[model samples]
Target: MGIIDFFVNLLKDPRGFIAGWIVALGPIWVYTPLFLIVFVETGLVFFPFLPGDSLLFAAGVFSADGGGLNLWATLIVFYLAAVLGNTSNYWIARLFGSRIIDSGKVKALTPERMAKLDHFFERYGGLTIVITRFMPFFRTFAPFIAGTGHMNFAKFTFFNVIGGVTWVSLFVLVGYFFGGVPFVQEHFEVIVLGIVAVSVAPAFIGVIKAAMNGRKGKGGE
Candidate 1:
């Protein structure tokens, strides 16, 4: 398939994508692309749309018994990718976040989204890093915002690790334990979409709330 078609397939059905890679790249090398996907999704502020939660769940499904991937290895690769990804994003923002924000180059970081993140930071403090780990777009942006706001590096690291470990472990283990069910096997695509919806729901809700609050503030003024 062409590159665009390949990614379209990957986004549409991550399980099939992982299965294809497992066969094509063998059990060992498949982890490379998986690593890169998770890394880029979390690391690059511009690429938040990449599938992170579904990808991990799909990887977990493959890592199950007789599924051709080593459970431990899959976990380790994802853990490292997630942690290192956030660290790089953090530093990138620390050094250049202001310029990036001012340039209006990243369409992903909309004013509504930024307001939501600011609310998260103000309410959760360092724990915002951990909380946003389960959130898709926010996960990618939280570290960058933290860096731009001059949050303590040590605090960010602590929460980043916690969030990474918790987020990866929860989704992967859920798939590992339940992905083999007959219903899941038959309706894997639907299930993947469900995962995406559930994962994105919180961020969606937060954005709506932020918009409403913005309107209320304007009314008050």
Candidate 2:
């Protein structure tokens, strides 16, 4: 329960957590936690719900404050985490996608979602990785689906690198530049929430579309 509360706080106020950690543990230790969170969020399917965008934004805010954390180091770490996380997910799907799907043990890899992901890959090809980088659940699932679909590794790598860097840069820079504005700083949590909402909105739309298609199929039956 305490662990659960900690993560909830993290999602709700990443800035608070990062700030506190920097104060208590000093700057050097903050990177490891950030790295782990980003890696888990992007690498593991079950952890897509973790606060990737917000965390990066908060880290950027901290970096902007000049609180011992080097901005370049933070960006480099984030970029590596994002890329490696997706790489891990891709290899996992490539190796065990069928077995995992058949076993039904993992809730995130449901047949319906996998089918939709496959369709998304078919429609978008390697570009799905790039596009989904800004999307919530899809960002985590894209690499996995591409692996299962046997997308050319070279093509996947190209788009993955671009998406990873762009996604991190956009959120982090926004925080670094505008996060200190009194309005934003005062309503920091609100802004973070808004960022998160915008990030996941596309996935919600896709879910709505899928539901409509499902209903249409039933009606036709």
Candidate 3:
């Protein structure tokens, strides 16, 4: 009924929430969930609210046991998914980024916020692709901003590969390694929450840093 409730339902049963993607393209599609997950999480503008980090964490946990999904296959699927997903998100920005810039929906994005993200991408550059990959919610927007700014496509792609591979590898290996513990199995919710916190902490830190910087700059100006 409510936004939180709807998201809670999704968090409870991803397969149910992700049924459209699963049903439309089965395993024959090779990392179907990975593709759609990455696509919605990154590629689609309307889907900023989707579970990017948590889903990856869950996928990692699921893949740990080798549950009919080979580790290599999972990695390959997710890696490609993440890479393609960002590329797609970037182009989507290229296509419609200008249109949204002045819209009410984007009003939440103050110039200071834009400047912060700009400063981040500037300072980190392509490596933002790599570093933010490990970060949770931030990963979804990195490529989008890169594209919106018309950063070199070739450069973005290079880091996309690095980030995608690194991101998928860490989580899948994590799932593969610690997924089988009885305690983790019993307390999956706690684990998922922890993952969410870990993933979100970076964005939280970034926002706080940005806010502090904004205040200091204003005071100085």
Candidate 4:
């Protein structure tokens, strides 16, 4: 498939795409892209749109009985990918986040999103790291924002490990257990979309709430 088609397939049908990879790449080599996707999605703030949640769920499905992948291996690879990815993003931000944010180059880091992240940090404190792990766009940006001096390395790592393990385990095991149901097998694409929607709902809600608050402030003035 062409590059566009490749991503299109990945986005549209993560389960089918992953199953194809297991067949084509075999059990061992398939972990490379799995690792890379999770890594890049978490590590690179610009790639927040990547399918982190759905991909994990899909991998979990494939790791089921008679499925090609080993459950333990999948879990380990994802755990490492998630933790290391956040660590990489944290350092990148600690070193260059201000410059990157000021450069006006990353269109994804919008004013509203930044404000939302700030709200999370202020409201949740260091626990924001663990909380946002299940949130798609926020998860990608949380470490970067934390690394901008809102949090120190030691504290960040504590929540990072907790968040990574919890997030990966939850989605993967859910998929492993439920992916074979008749409804899920019949409507896998729909399920993937549902996962993406549920994962992104909080970020959308935060944006709406922020917009509303901005309006209220203007009215009070």
Candidate 5:
């Protein structure tokens, strides 16, 4: 598996993964790895489940130390990654999204799912792209969808910048500010799990609501 895949899988046992990494990479890996992780996470839809929030948080925590990289530096690297990643995904959608969708290679984005996502992007437009940056599968698909729908580039960039900067700053700052606390250090995995769970909540709610409506329609029929 690739490096991102390794990190993503390690999230399944986050506590161990985080500890191992702080020791293994020391502080130098922080610079390039930060850029690469965010880039791939946003750029490649297949790697959506990779850890963005937690990774940033971890980087922030590292930056707080004397040997670690600078917090602002980390933010800059990842922010660029986020924007460029979506930009790449946007082009990918422009060129091949429909062809792939039409070919039925991707079963998750069925006609119904595609319609639902379109409705979501229309309702929220570029904000949908930015906000879903924190989300898992949705984050990966949002830019791709925007490409397919032919969302205006200027608008996409606006929200994309806001979302990328804000999302990176929020998590990184939080990790920098509070990462050293005994509770956080000890329960890091729990926190990561909580974040992941909350991140997926909207999608979960959507699925539940859809299921309920389906049941109601069947009953009425």
Candidate 6:
């Protein structure tokens, strides 16, 4: 199959794909692509649509079921991928943020959203990095905003590590414990979608809250 078809299949059933990969490619060979998926999802701003939470959960399930991927190694690889992804994203923002914003070539970086994120970073300071890690689209954007805003590297690194480790551990552990349940196994793709929905819900709520608050402030004025 072509590249697009290949990724579509993988995204459609990441759990099965990972399991098959483990069986076919073995533990050692599977790490690179897995790591790159997690890394590119966050590290490259243009590719946030890549599956992050489901992939981790699926990896956990594969590892738990005596698949080729070991439990501890899965966690470590994913955690590092996440951490390094954010770090790379931040540096990319620092280096090319203004040019990207000014050029307006990328459709995702809308002015209003960037302003909101800028305000978010300013309002929450360093913790935004940690908080957004569990939230889908925002998680990718938070570090970029931090970099664009010139947030201190030390502070960014501190929270980046915490967020990366926590996020990876949570989903992976969830998958290990619950992913192989009979119901879940039968309906794995639906569950993966559910996971993504739940992960993105917080950021969605936050956006709604902010919008409501903005309206209230306007009414008051």
Q: lDDT of each prediction vs. the true structure?
A: 0.90, 0.84, 0.69, 0.92, 0.76, 0.84
Count steric clashes of candidate 2: 0
Model 4, span 34-127: residue lDDT tens: 9999999889887888889999999999989988989999999999999999999999999999999999888989988888889889999989
| Candidate 2 per-residue C-alpha lDDT over 64-157 given as tens digits, one digit per residue, 9 for 90 to 100 | 8664567888899999999999999888889987786678776866567677778778788787898888988778888888878758788889
Q: With candidate 2 superimposed using the best TM-score fit, by how many Å does residue 48's alpha carbon deviate from the native?
A: 1.5
The CA-based lDDT of model 1 is what?
0.90
Give lDDT tens digits, candidate 3, residues 121-168: 878888987887766556666677788974889999998998888887
- Candidate 6, 211: how far from true, in Å? 5.8
Please give the range of 10 consecutive residues that has the lowest summed lDDT in model 2: 61-70
Model 2 Cα shift for residue 55 (angstroms) = 0.8
Of the two candidates 3 and 5, the one with more favorable lDDT, higher being better, is 5
- The best candidate by TM-score is 4
Q: For model 6, give the 10-residue run with minimal summed lDDT.
A: 106-115
lDDT of 1 by residue, 1-221 (tens): 98667666787799878888899999899999999999998899988888899999999999899998989999999999999999999999999999999999999999878877888888889999999888889999999999897488999999999999999999999999998999999999999888899989998887787788889999999
Q: Pick the candidate with the highest lDDT.
A: 4
For candidate 5, write residues 123-143 as lDDT tens digits: 877678777777777777788
Q: What lDDT score goes with residue 194 in model 5?
A: 82
Q: Return whichever of 1 and 4 wins on lDDT.
A: 4
TM-score of every model versus the real structure: 0.95, 0.93, 0.81, 0.96, 0.87, 0.89
Ranking by lDDT: 4, 1, 2, 6, 5, 3
Cα RMSD of all models vs. native, in order, equals: 1.6, 1.5, 3.5, 1.2, 2.6, 2.4
Considering TM-score, where higher is better, how would the candidates rank from best to worst?
4, 1, 2, 6, 5, 3
CA-RMSD of model 6: 2.4
Q: Candidate 3: where is the Cα deviation over 4 Å?
A: 1-6, 12-31, 106-112, 216-221
Q: Candidate 6 overall Cα lDDT vs. reference? A: 0.84
**What TM-score does candidate 4 get on C-alpha atoms?**
0.96
What candidate 4 gets wrong by more than 4 Å, as runs, is 1-5
